[model samples]
Target: MALIEIERVCRLFEDPKRGKPVIALDNVNVRVERNEFLCLLGPSGCGKSTLLNMIAGFDHPSSGTVKVGGHVVSEPGADRGVVFQQANLMPWLPVWENVAFHLKMTGAPKAERRERAQKFIDMVGLRGFENHYPSELSGGMNQRVGIARALLMNPEVILMDEPFGALDEQTKMDMHAELVRIWRESQSTIVFVTHSIEEALALGTHVAVMSARPGRIRELLPIDLDRPRDTTSAQFNDYKRHILHLLRPESEHRLEQAA
Candidate 1:
């Protein structure tokens, strides 16, 4: 069975302003294989985060189903780890404490938490900042702490909602490399939501593009490029062009019509 299965899922929210329910996702279907970096990409307001939330068990579908590791997702669980757009770290706590918060919550011993936290801290290139507070670190470093925390959980899947969206281009490039390395070393399954097509091309084994609001998966294109992919290569440009074509306004308008 696919490690993560989403079958004809739809999410409807009661829009208070309009006095009508807004459809966030319409009959969405996606299956994520184990240990693949699947990047969820589309224009803003396309419900990318909403779809990811279903997989992470942060929200439920109004209809159909979402399953991870062969179990229907009904509520948030430790089996799935999440890295949000913001670091979401407590300012009072040191980096080590933040990274091991899950263990602390579950009543694990301090020594074990520290050891495991150190391992992943090193994995994300944050080895020396263990004792520093979130306020003491740069945005990028704080983000690394967030990633370390998720890795320490050793979950079956990691859900990221545009984790690097706020960083500068160079920092984002660096983080992209760090993430790919960590993903390789840990062999973790990741479903990342991003609006940046270039970022998706840089990180994902497969890119799933969605239509505009009331989103539906428009295409799933596999990337077979070599590691440390060259963005300037002809094949890379071809893929970029194809994704651009898929997300164009005309195509999106057509998609909604067909739906």
Candidate 2:
């Protein structure tokens, strides 16, 4: 079975000011297989984050179902981990402590927490900075800490919503490489939401291209390129062009389709 299944999901929000129910997602269907890095790619307000949130069980669909491991998702569970755009680390705690905070909440012994947190901290390349506070690290490093925290949970799936969006270009690129390595080592499924075409191309095994608000999956494209992708290559650019074409205004896209 697919590790994650989103079947004909729809989400509607009551827009009090507009006096209407706004459709955020309409009959969205997507499935993520085990260990696949799937990027939800589209413009802002495309319901990418909404989809991720549903998978994480932070929100529920207005209709249809979201299932993980063949069980319906109802509320937040430890089986799924989440890393948000912001690290959201506790400012006062050191890195290791922050990464192991979940364990701490469960009354785990400190030594056990330290050992488990160290494994993931090292996995994320933050071994030497375990004692540093969030304030002491760069934006990218803090994000690594957040990733490590999620990894420490040893969840089957990790949900990320534009975790690298705030980083500088160089830092984001570095994190992308690190994340790919971590994903391979951990063998965890990931569903990432991002607006950047290049970022989706760089990280995803498959890219789910979404339409504008009242979002729907336009296409799910397998990224058959080799790892450490060459962004300038013709094939890579071809994929980018196709995604851009899919993302064009609906009228323009239909015109091309009819041509």
Candidate 3:
């Protein structure tokens, strides 16, 4: 069975000012196999994050089902971890403490928490910074801490919402490489949401190109590019062009047709 299954899901929200319901997602179907890095790519307001939220069990679909490991997702569970755009780390706590906060909540002994958190901290390349507070770390380092926190849970899947969107270009690239390595080592499935075509191309094993709201998957393109992907290569450019064409507005297409 696919590790994650989203079958004909739909979500609607009440638009009081508009005096009607607004469709955010319509009949979205996606399947993610084990250990795949799937990027949900689309223009702004495409409901990518909404879809990610459903998988994280932060929200429910208005219709249809989202299943992880053959079980319906009804609420947040330890089987899935989420890393948001911001690290959202507690300012006062040091890196190790923040990464192991979940364990702390469960009443695990401090020594046990430290031991367990170290593996993920090392995995995310934050070993030397374990005692540093969030205020002492850079944006990218804090994001790494967030990733380490998620990994410490040893979840089957990790859901991310544009975690690198706020970083500088250089830092973002560095993080991408680190993330790919960590993903390979951990063997965890990931569903990432982003609007950048290059970012999607750089990271995803499969890119799920989505239409503007009400969002639907236009195509799920398998990214066959080799690791440490060459963004300037002809094949990479070809994929980018195809995704851009897929994301073009319907009205623009209609204009071309008229021309």
Candidate 4:
């Protein structure tokens, strides 16, 4: 069974000055399976992040519903963790404290929170930098803190919105491997959003290609590639070609017309 389901979801933003509304998503429907690494891929302004926000309970859909583990998602909870494009770590807090902030809010003791946060901090390869502030860390390191913070919640579902988009290509590749390792270790269902076809293929077991405006699912392609994916291999290029075709404007238009 699907771990998360979105049925006929739609989101519209009102343009008060223009006396019209902007359609962000149109009847978007999809299902995510348990421990599945699902990537929502599309062109810019395709409402990929918007859809993610709805699933994270940061925003509500104008129509339809989002369910996680068979429970309707009505508000943000500890069960679902979100890592945004920016690290969003608190400037005032050190790495360990930031990682355990959610626990701190729930009244978890200082020592317990420190112990739990350290485990994930080490998991993300920031072993000795636990006491460093966000400003002291590099971009990639800061992102690791964000990931570690989210994992501390032991969330059933982890939502990532292009979390590595801001990094350099080299850093991004490193983060990709780290993310795969973390996912394997944590066994958490991850719903990641990215514009890079290669990034999606590298991380996701299933890639959901979305359309341009008034976003809708153009295709739900299953990627059967092996772990520690080889981007330079023939099979990888073949799969990338297939996904690239599906993301083309004309291809999306034809599919929409057919539907």
Backbone clash count, each prediction separately: 0, 0, 0, 0
Cα misplacement distance, residue 73 of candidate 4 (Å): 1.1
| lDDT string, candidate 2, 1-259, tens digits | 9999999999999999999999999999999999999999999998999999999999999999999999999999999999999999999999999999999999999999999899999999987898999999999999999999999888999999999999999999999999999999999999999999999999999999999999999999999999899999999999999999999979897788899
Per-model TM values vs. the true structure: 0.95, 0.98, 0.98, 0.95
Backbone clash tally for model 2? Answer: 0
Worst 10 residues of 3 by lDDT: 248-257
Ten contiguous residues minimizing lDDT sum, candidate 1: 248-257
Worst 10 residues of 4 by lDDT: 245-254
Ranking by TM-score: 2, 3, 1, 4
| Best model number under TM-score | 2
Task: Give the winner by TM-score: 2 or 4.
Answer: 2
Q: Provide the overall lDDT of each model, using Cα atoms, as 2-decimal numbers.
A: 0.93, 0.95, 0.96, 0.94
Q: Which stretches of candidate 3 lie over 4 Å from their true place?
A: 254-259
Which portions of model 2 show Cα errors greater than 4 Å?
Answer: none
Error of 1 at 92 (Å): 1.0
lDDT of 3 by residue, 1-259 (tens): 9999999999999999999999999999999999999999999898999999999999999999999999999999999999999999999999999999999999999999999999989999987999999999999999999999999999999999999999999999999999999999999999999999999999999999999999999999999999999999999999999999999997888899999
lDDT for 192 (candidate 1): 97
Candidate 4 yields a Cα-based lDDT of: 0.94
RMSD of each: 2.4, 0.8, 1.1, 2.3
Clashing pairs in 4: none
Misplaced by over 4 Å in model 1 are 251-259
